[model samples]
Target: MSDTDDLVEIEQLLARYAVSMTRGDVDRVLAVFTPDGAYSAFGDTYPLDEFPALISAAPKGLFLVGTPVIELAEDGATAAGTQPLCFVEHAQHGMRIGYYNDTYVRTPDGWRLRTRAMTFIRRSGDHDSGRPHAFTRS
Candidate 1:
């Protein structure tokens, strides 16, 4: 396939991931990742097999994922991208903002995530968060 096709497929993969998580579909979520995929968040990394537990521990939320900025590899066998994320919690009506760093690998089955990690961009009044603002003059 061409580079455009690869990019589109990766984009689709990311969309599927968000949808699956929002729907609490474990199997669908796993399908986007490679067999040995690893997801890192909350200061811990969970292997592919532990994803179900991770999913279970996840809070119910609406995941609003932004379009990823993807870059293809020279050989087109791998790719990487970063996508912004916004999650609105159901119980507390709270919100969390973050971005996902994902590495993609082309498998015989299609494009799948090799690794996925999240970095949160905390806002003011957020619990356990540090200064979440731009520098200001005193």
Candidate 2:
């Protein structure tokens, strides 16, 4: 596939991630990542194997994902980008805005997340009530 194709696929992968997380579909969310993938947020890192439990422990909410500025590697097997996200926590009655720094790999199944590091920019309303701590970008 061309670079453009890769970029589109990667963006779609990120979208799927947001949708899955919003729906609290831990399985689908995990599918978007590679077997050894890692997710970092609020100063904690969770490996793929432990991700499901972590996600399941969180409150359900609406997660809106913005388009990312993707940069494809020359070899076309790797890519990186930063995407803005808005999360509305129903249980907590709050919202958190953040950005995800992502690394993607062209796996046999398609583009998968290798690593995703999230940094929150703002939080409002019962923000501290959620399992994930409120954070600000430094």
Candidate 3:
């Protein structure tokens, strides 16, 4: 595929992830990542296998993801991207605004995230309630 094609695919991949995660579809969310993928947030990084629980543990919300800025690697096998995120709470009157830093790999199944880290910029209401899952960007 051409670089444009790759960029489109990666953009769609990011959309897929946001939609799936907002819908709380664990399987679909997992599909956007490599089998050995890892997600970092809440001051911890969870392996692919642990992602489901991490998903379940979060409050239900709608993920409003901004357009991603992606940079393809010279090797053509990897890429990096970042996007703004707004997680509006559905289960409660709360919200968490953040951004995602992602590392993508060209798997046989297509572009998948190898690593995804969330950096929270703000939180409020039930979202800021005594849940110890908040973390900062490094």
**Highest lDDT, which number?**
3
Give the clashing pairs for model 2: none
Candidate 2 regions with alpha-carbon error over 4 angstroms: 123-138
lDDT of 1 by residue, 1-138 (tens): 999899899999999999889888999999999999998776667789988877886688888999999989998799999999998988897988888888999999999999998888866534322233222212
Candidate 2 matches the true fold with a TM-score of: 0.85
Candidate 2: worst-modelled 10 consecutive residues by lDDT? 122-131
Query: By the TM-score metric, which is better: model 1 or model 2?
Result: 1
Q: After superposition, how far is residue 131 of candidate 1 from its true place, in Å?
A: 15
List where candidate 1 sits over 4 angstroms from the true fold.
124-138
Q: Which stretches of candidate 3 lie over 4 Å from their true place?
A: 123-138
Per-prediction CA RMSD (Å)? 7.6, 5.2, 4.9
Clashing pairs in 3: none
> Each prediction's TM-score against the native?
0.87, 0.85, 0.87
Q: Relative to the true structure, how large is the alpha-carbon lDDT of every model?
A: 0.84, 0.82, 0.85
- The residue-by-residue lDDT of candidate 2 on 40-125, one tens digit each, is 87567778987877786666799988999998888878888999888899877688787888999998899999999877774453
